[model samples]
Target chain A: MSEGKGGGETVELLLPATPERLALARTTGAAIASRWRFTYDEIADLRLAIDELCLTLIRPAQQEGEPRRLTLAYTLDGSSMVVRGQVDKPNPAAVNGDGQAPQPTSVSDLSERILDALVDEHGSERTDSQLSAWLRKGRSVAAP
Target chain B: MEEVFEIAEYSDDSTPVLSVRGEIDVSTAPELRDRLLGVAQDGYSTVVVDLSEVTFLDSTALGVLVSGLKRFRSAGGDLRLVVTGRNVTKVLEITGLVEVFPIFDSVSEAVST
Candidate 1:
């Protein structure tokens, strides 16, 4: 869990990068998004987005072998929340030497369309050692 | 963890209906795919997936449904969806799948059409 440097709240979770653990990730993200005053529709979008993002990391990590795990960080700042996820053991083939943000290879076209409609911003980052994906959503003004 | 997924199959006249409850993600999508395949193999010409009780579904589930639809359609059959929940309908809309699959508000409506 990474601590928030400012006054914003950040929650971090670590779970095995398996399909069975996806529900826990979605539930946790929904709880945090609810607390941050996101609308019902917004929460639903976040839940789906989190599921897609986690699965995007999990599928490749699962093929690589043991100790498959995912680290998720949810940071609530002002009217928006940012969720960042990284596989503990990244696929060797996915690591980049140029320190550029590499696209996640496992995201299906359906996942791409869903994320495009749900989140404000999303992308993946890969360095020499690790790969991560993140999404940010701003609370809808229609919420009371 | 307790079970958060369930799928039951039955018939409305000659058409088959798969009533699903709880979330459908990667973990539970295989079960769905299997059942859809089972229906197709059993020679059902039309099938309805009743997702009115479904609370959540991801792209994996969508892919499964799309595959099932393709299988049925290839054989001169069709796949229909019954989605009453806003979230589920919103997902179908987001992916523009609402235009792809025949969607209804209830099982009866889907089975009828």
Candidate 2:
């Protein structure tokens, strides 16, 4: 299948939810965004946004050897790119550290706002056994 | 494989400083965290992080820095950063942390301040 120059393509990655492997996800996301003709600044934003999403998925349990796997599904739709991230956890809200969530002004909430600023639009939802976040950024005219 | 990140420590006017190169991401943040914490634990009144050579800086790394900053401030010292990369600066701006830290354009400026 030819994705064509600046054509749309979808890339999916599944990796352990370990910090050591998080770099792989960031690099892959940036590479795919670059292929889609995103600008350097756009690619940088995509990398950091994806990094924040992945960090949100990290659980202290991960350090105990019951490593979880994160599935990142990224789609480049010609004019824009969208990255959907999911993990094994059922409730995305459950990923919230403690029942008492951080205030919108708290430092813990700062990362989420950073992701919000980096991407054109972002959202997250949870399912029976999966927690997912979707990040989107438009392609630049210079991309070919 | 070249280290994803490298840290070099030095003293500028007797103020401890960390010269960090490469990407500051999840894979390498812990090392940075440990080193910064160590500096604080050792009772450095003030410290500067030179991130001019950092190619990428992520939220995890920022969290570590903020944690370190808080640690230092509570001890009556302060943590400062020298950031030059657009990528690093962009994140700092977006997070509103650009106002929180004393950011300098050069190591000398950060150290002198």
Candidate whose TM-score is highest: 1
Question: Taking the tens digit of each residue's C-alpha lDDT, what string does model 2 give over B25-104?
Answer: 86788899999988987879689999999988876788789888998888888999999988888888988899999999
Model 1 steric clash pairs:
none
DockQ of all candidate complexes: 0.59, 0.61
Candidate 1, B35: how far from true, in Å? 0.3
Tens-digit lDDT string for candidate 1 (A77-103): 667888999886475674456533233
Backbone clashes under 3 angstroms, per model? 0, 0
For each candidate, what is the lDDT?
A: 0.84, 0.78
lDDT of 1 at A4: 67
Error of 2 at B91 (Å): 0.9
Best by lDDT: 1
Interface RMSD of each: 2.3, 2.3
| Per-residue lDDT of model 2, residues A1-144, tens digit only | 235335667788889878887788888888887777788888888888888777666543253346578888888765888787777854434445433222223435866788778888877665667666677788767554
